[model samples]
Target: MHAIEVCNLKKSYTQGENALDSISFHIPQGAIFGFLGPNGSGKTTTVRILNGILSPTQGSALVYGQKVTANSQEIHRLCGVMTETAASYENLTGWENLDFFGQMHGLSKTEIKNQSEQLLYSLDLYESKDKKVKAYSTGMKKRISLARALLHRPKILFLDEPTSGLDPESAQNVTQMVQKLAIEHGVTVFLCTHQLKYAEDICTLYGFIHKGNMLGFGTFQQLLQEKNSTIYLELRGDSIPPSFTPYQNANKIYKIPITGDTDASQILQGILKQGGQVYEAKQIHWGLEDLYFAYQRGVSHEISTKSNDL
Candidate 1:
C-alpha cells in the first residue's frame, strides 16, 4: 500500500503564482523517499499540502489511502511532521517539549516518559534533557524536534531538512535513525531536502521538483536508468594493452567504460593476458547528486530554449 499519494496536485497562493504545479507520485510503505529540489522549488509547499496545512488549488493528496482533506485529523494522527523551523517553547526543557507534544498526540504520561527517554538517549540529547530549549545548541534543538515528532510513534514521518543545522555526527545519527524507523518499524519517511549527497546515502526512493513542476520521481537505480548512466571500471597497476588504453587516469588509476558484467570480465581477462597486475577494479556508478544535476541542466536548457522561442 502507498504511504502517501498525490494526484495532479497543484497549489497557488495567488491568482497566477503557483507554488506547486500538477505533480503526481506515490510513496510506498516503509520507504524513505527523498523529496529533492532547489530553494523555492515547491518542495515545502507540497509537504504542506500533503499534511493538510494548506489546501491545494486543484487535485488531491491522500495519506494512507484517505483523502487528506476529509481525514485531516486521522492523517495528522498517523504522521509525524518536523519542519525546518523547530517549534517549541523557549522556556521549556527538551524533555518538557517532547512531553507536551506527546500529550497532544494523546500518549499517556507513562508512554510519553518512556518514548522521550528512548529518543533523548538515542539522539544523544539525554545529557541536556533538563536544559531549557533556549539554551540548547542548534543541533540539540533539531534533535529535540525530532524526538517530539517521533514521540507518538507515528507511521509516517514528514521531515523537512531534518539534518539541517546539525553537525556531521548528528546528521549521520539522524539519517541512521530515519533509515532504522523505515526498515525496522515499517514507518514511511518523506524527507524533503536539497542535500543530494546526504539524501543519496539514506533514501530508498526519490522525487525531484523544479519550478513548481515534478521533474522526476523514482528509485535511485530507476533514475540512473532514465539518465542512462554509464558504468566505469577503475583499473590499477598498468601494463595497459593498446586496446586497453584507459580513457581517464588519475593517480595511477585507469578508468574504463564497460557495458555489463560480461564486458568487465572480458576486460579483466585481456588485462591479465597483457601481464597487467589486477590491483583493483571497481565499478563507479552515479549517485543522486549526479542524477539531480543532470536532470536540472536539461530542465534549464529546455526552459531557456522555450524563452528564446517566445
Candidate 2:
C-alpha cells in the first residue's frame, strides 16, 4: 500500500482564492518524499490537510489506505510530526516535556525512558536534559521537539523544516538517523523542506509546487524526460565528426545536448564509427537544484515536456 496518497487535493480559505489547487501525488512505504515550495506556497497547508488538522475544501488525503478524516486519531498515533512551530512547554524541563508527550502517545514508563534517553544522546541534548525549555537555546528546543516526536517510534514521520535551527553537525546526525529509520524500520518520511541540496542528498522522490500548483513529481530518473533537463557532453577529439558542428569557442570540440540515455549512447557510437578519436569529454548533469529552479522560472504547471511520462 502507498504510505500516503492525495487525489486532486484542493484547499481554499477565501471565496475565490485557493491555497492548494488540484494537487495529486503518492509516496511509497519506506521512501523519503520531499515536498518543496516557497513560503506561502501551500506547503504547510498541505501538511495540515494530510494530518487531518485541517480539512480540504475538495478531494481527499489517505494515509496507508485510511482516509485522513475518518481515521484522524489513528493516523495521529501512527505519525511522528515535528513542525517548524511545534512548541514545548517553557516551564517544563526537557525530560518533562518528552515524558508528557510520551505518555500522550500511550508509551509506558520503560518505553519512554529507553526512547527518550536514546534520542537525547543521539541529538546531543543529554547534557541539558534537566534544563527547563524556557532556558534552552533555539537549537536545543528544536532537538527536544524532535525527541518528543520520535518517542513513540512511529511508523510515519511528517517533518517540516526539521533542521532549521540545528547546527551542521546536528543536522547531519538527524538526517542519518532519519535515513536509518526509513531504510531499516520501513518508516515512511514526508519531509517538507526548502533545503534543496540537503533534500537532494537524502530524498528518493520529490514533488515541487509553485503558486499552489504541483509543477512536477517523480524520481530524478523519471523526470529526466522533462524538457527542463539537458545532459550535455562536450567532446574534443583528434578528428571531429562532420555530422556534428564544432563548438564555437574551441576548435575540434563538439558540444552535444543529450535528451535521453539512448541519445548519449548513439552519439558515442556514431563518433567511433566516423573514426573520431576522442581525447577528452566532459559531461554536465542536471540535479534537483537545477530542475527546481527550472520549475520556479516557469509560468504554469507545464514544466514537464512529456504529457504523462514524468
Could you tell me the C-alpha RMSD of candidate 1 in Å?
Answer: 6.7
Report the lDDT tens digits of candidate 2 across residue range 78-176.
888898867899999999999999999888999999999999999999999999999998888888888988899888898888888889998899899
Q: Assess the local accuracy of residue 67 in candidate 2 as a C-alpha lDDT between 0 and 100.
A: 95
Task: Score residue 96 of candidate 1 by CA lDDT.
Answer: 85
Give the clash count for model 1: 0
Compute the lDDT of residue 264 as modeled in candidate 1. 81
Q: How many steric overlaps are in each model, in order?
A: 0, 0
- Tell me each candidate's TM-score: 0.87, 0.86
Tens digits of per-residue lDDT for model 1 on 87-184? 77779999889888888889999999999999999999999999999999888878888888899899999898899899999998998899999999
